[model samples]
Structures are given as C-alpha cells and as structure tokens.
Target: MNTLFMHCRPGFEGEVCSEISDHAARLNVAGYAKAKPQSACAEFICHEPEGPQRLMRELRFAELIFPRQWARGEFVPLPESDRIGVLLEHLSNLPTCSSVWLEVLDTNDGKELSTFCRKFEVPLRKALIKAGKLQEDGNGPRLLLTFKSGREVFVGLADADNSAMWPMGIPRLKFPREAPSRSTLKLEEAWHHFIPRDQWDARLNGDMTGVDLGAAPGGWTYQLVRRGMLVTAIDNGPMAESLMDTGLVQHLMADGFTFKPKQTVDWMVCDIVEKPARNAALLETWLGEGLCREAVVNLKLPMKQRYAEVRRLLDRIADGFKARGVKVSIGCKQLYHDREEVTCHLRRLDMKPRPSH
Candidate 1:
C-alpha cells in the first residue's frame, strides 16, 4: 500500500491528516500526509514497502465516510520526470489491490492534459463531448464555473490553480444574511460527496432521531427534520419559527445537558457554545448511559493546539464507549458552516439501548 487515496470530509483536510499522522506514529506505519489542492482528498503515501498493506488492514476510517471504505491506489505522474511503471511496480504488491486514479492537481498546456488523458484512458474526445467542455475541434474543456455543491467537474486543468480545496464557495465568519429555507439548505451543494437522493434517502430512517442543542437559528435542525424524524431542540433561546412550524421537531426550553427526553432518542446533536471537553463529556454521558443510538455534535475550539484538542477528545470519547461495552463509529469535520468548531457524528453500539422511563 504505497499510496492510498483518502477522501476526507470537505474542509477537514488538516484534521484528517493530523489524525492519520498520529495513527501512523502509534502503529509505526511509515508515511506522511499531504493535502490535494483539488479537493478534500488527502494523499497518504508510504515510504516503507509494507506500509500500505499493513495500514489498510488496520485502517479504521472515520464514520462520516463510513461504509464507504478508502480506495487504495497511487499517483501515476510525479516530479515532472518520473516513470509511471516504476511507481506502479513499487505499489503492486499490496493485497487485493487493483487500478489507479490519475490525481492531476494541476495542468499546463494542452499537451500535458492530452498526455494524462491518454495515459489514464480518459477518452478526452468523448469525455469532452459528454461534459460539453470541448468544441467541434476537440481542443477545449474550458468552463470557469463555481458550484456551491461538492460535485466533481472537469474544469480546464489550467483553471484548477489557486482553487480552494474545500470549495465552500467562500468562507464566511457569520451566518447568511438572508433567512434559510429548503432552497437554502442545498443538500446537493452541502454534502456533495454523498450519493444522490435515492441512496441519501435510504440512509435516513425512522429508526434514527436526534436532539439539536443550542438549535436557535435552526440550520442543523432543518437538515435533521428533512430526514422525517423528530428532533428535540434544547436551548433557553427559541428556534426559528420555521423549524417549529415543521411539526417534526419538539422544542424543549432547558439546558441540553439536563434535558433528558421522556425516552431515549436515536441520536443527540449539539452545537452549543462550550469548551470541547465539556461537550465531549456530554456526548460521553449520553453515549455511556445508552441514552441515544448516535450523535452529531459540535465542539467550539479555542486557538492553540486545536489539533491536539481534537486528538484528546477523540481518545476520550472512544475510551468512554469502549468501557461501556459499546462499539461505536465516529467522524469529525470542520464543516463549511463551521467557524471555530468541528462537527462530530457518532453512532453508538447498534444494539438497542437500555429502556428508559
């Protein structure tokens, strides 16, 4: 496993890379993490011969992208003067591995693009015709377009330079100036890595429910409700009237930590203004008590070792679940909507939780 193509959540390159580096150190895998400028994909290229196969076997990917395992492959072109076969031979020994995706981060003249397409069997003329990126002369793939969603588009390779990796359109320190709606929710644009509606809808089921702590403005709640499950909104403040109007949510005017539902819900979600450890503890408590089936919460982080803090919280949460005989899945990402906090999604042991009065 010389090179593994890791797809991190959009805008979470640093967190994913740091976690991988830490895992490598602990497991003694010889590798370093590098960001791919084109998107949230990170390249985990191993220097040691056996590192790829070993790491992939032991790899426990984050839960957000769970069930969707990391695809194992390597970069074909390198250093502007390397042979693709030389690199491929070095990568060949990994078990049950096949195929490589040409990860072109940048392109110069038409020659380079054409060469890459030829090497990858990308069918330049056909792809261009299908994508409408070429002329009758078959010489252009130029389209300077901006997608708020995370779709994969073939821009003129030249146009890829200086692009933001996460593609959030642009970073904003504040919420939107206008009110949000289904139109504003933009599921396609927001979670572009996910498959389209059919698969996405299948992911949603009545078996799962959620709580939205500090769910005032209601953007997060909106996402949950659209899934057709009830959400308990815990906050002293009020939610957007629009969310309350949905009838899929229950507004509870109490502190999130103290407000236990009449029955354990399937999920607990929070975005409260609190320290990371404090939020982590709340998550642990709910998870440990079998109070919920899963959770998607946010922890507001301070400057200085934000990465280290994430490491600490991940350990704390994982340890807590293990002690409780819970098999859990967890993921964290600095979402496009996240400013100084990271979003976490955790699913507790799939076994039914203990009955609550």
Candidate 2:
C-alpha cells in the first residue's frame, strides 16, 4: 500500500525533498520522490518493501493522511471569522483534502451556527445544537469545515479536541481574535512546527537548555520557559516582564552571534533579522565550537527563491556538521503561520559530546 505525507508550501517542494533525502540517508535508508502534480504534493515512494507510515511519522512538518487517494471531511475551528482565509489556504494544500465548509458557531451566545455550513452540505457529524448555543469562552466551534465536496469529514479524526487545521501556504499570520495577548497564532503556528512534539517534550522536561538569539518580548523564550529549561535570552531589547518573572530566563543583552555561552547548552534558537547566510554562519559558529548540542532556528528568506535558499542552507549545514564527525537530524517546514521564512530543527550526531567552549 502507498502512504503519502503532505508538506505545506508549494514553493518549498525541493527543499522538502532535499531534507527528506538527507534524513533517510542519515539513517542508512533510501526512498524515491516525485511531484504529485494532481495535488501539488510530493510523493515519496519507499522502494524497500515496507509501508511509508514510519517515515511519515518521523517527519516534523509533513502530516500523514492515510489511504493515499481517500477523501474525508476536515473541521478547522477558527478563533474567529477573520481566520477564514487562513483556513482556506490550509485546506487547499492537503493531498487528499478538498470541498471545504465553514461552521460559524455564534459566539455571542454559544451555539453551532451551521446555517452557512448547511448550505455547503456539511454533515451534522454531531449536533450539539445546545453546545453551539452557549456564550463562547472563545473556544466555540469556529471551525473551518472541509472534505471532498460530497464526502464525510470524519475519515481521520484525531484524538485531540482543538480540531485539526490543515497546513497551508501562509505568508504571515495575524493574531487570533481571542488569544490572551495580541500575538499572532499564525506566526506561532509556523514556529511550532520546526521542532517535533517529541523533541519539545524532552526540552520541557529539563532534559535541555537553549539560547534564544534575538529573544525580545520572549515569544520563543516563553515556549522554552514553559518547558522548564533555562534560556539565555540574547537581545539588546527588553523581554516581556512576565518572562523575566519566571526566574528560569537569564537576560543577556548582547549580540547573539558574538556572545558565547558559559557552557555547552542543549539547543540554540535564533530569530534575528539578519541575512540568512549570517544566521547560517552563526549556527555554524555555535556548532563548530560545540557551544550547543542541538538547534532550532529561523531563517528569514528573501521574497523570491525562498525554497532554493532553504535547500542551499540545509546542505551547507549538513556538510559542515558531517565533516566534523557530527551526525545531525534536521527538518524544515513552512508552517501554518509562517511568512517568507522557514524554521529548522537539528540534532547532533554525537548525543553525548564532550563539553567545549
């Protein structure tokens, strides 16, 4: 049976392929890929006689949808009506996903406002007519409903309650209507995809320490702090007062590239507004000097050739690490909230390397 993984962003197909190839090769495995023209997705065929689910599960940004050619309904619960466009783009990228529906639950009084949804023939998978009638605690059924025009949307129901939103092409995302702060969920979404959930758990358990380059306002730092890890936030600007209050953060008002950590950290994260190459070099310096064990950083891309740039950088980073007898596992994704940039996650080959500055 053929299983496929759906990667976001049409432009980054080549980069996705390169990253996949490197990942497989690093594990001493092989696979084949070609553009899946019909859906604008990449089809990686595992020539070895096993199913591709294992590989798909290992991928960070690529989502695994089963029964390659099957059609199913998808419900995307938006934070508000404004997110409709984001919902649309996300649905469009699914290899086997289509026929979108919008379920606008009335939040004034919590209720399933499926009037618009009914017009599109959205199946009443479950009618919590009363559920949609209550005043929304900002978590009502503001879902972006999708499926093959005439198919049911419950084919691959996830165990989570947030309602899954497909990873679509996003240039940038504004803040959602009901978040505690005015920060953009779209941007956070993009940033979240860089590091896999598994790796995130490790960091949160105090199994890691990281450096947050250009970490002002502490958005990324907030994520690290919640994970219960110490973060050396390197930035000249002030971080959010709440972040400093956490006591796990060490405010380092200095240049990220020039400042070396007192000891080897578990990870390095950068979000500086420098050229991609400069960011790449900074990562190299950290790795070359063994300042950190692993990394997850952002590369702000130029308007055009964003895909090409990602490919080039990944190759350089991999080559650099390999030459130094360091093995690395890396993945990049154009997340649901990303704009003109991509995020990378890297793990060192030598899990237990000697500490060096």
- Candidate with best TM-score: 1
TM-score, candidate 2, is: 0.56
**lDDT (C-alpha, whole model) for all candidates:** 0.55, 0.53
lDDT of 2 at 12: 48
Task: Indicate which candidate wins on lDDT.
Answer: 1
State the displacement of the C-alpha of residue 197, model 2, in Å, after optimal TM-score superposition: 4.0
Go through the candidates in order and give the C-alpha RMSD of each one to the true structure: 10.1, 11.0
After superposing candidate 2 on the true structure, give the runs of residues whose Cα lies further than 4 Å from its correct spot: 1-200, 353-357
Please provide TM-scores, in order, for all candidate models, with all chains considered together: 0.59, 0.56
Question: What are the runs in model 1 whose C-alpha is more than 4 Å off?
Answer: 1-17, 31-45, 60-122, 125-203, 206-209, 324-327, 333-339, 353-357
lDDT of 1: 0.55
**Residue 283 CA displacement from its true place in model 1, Å:** 0.6
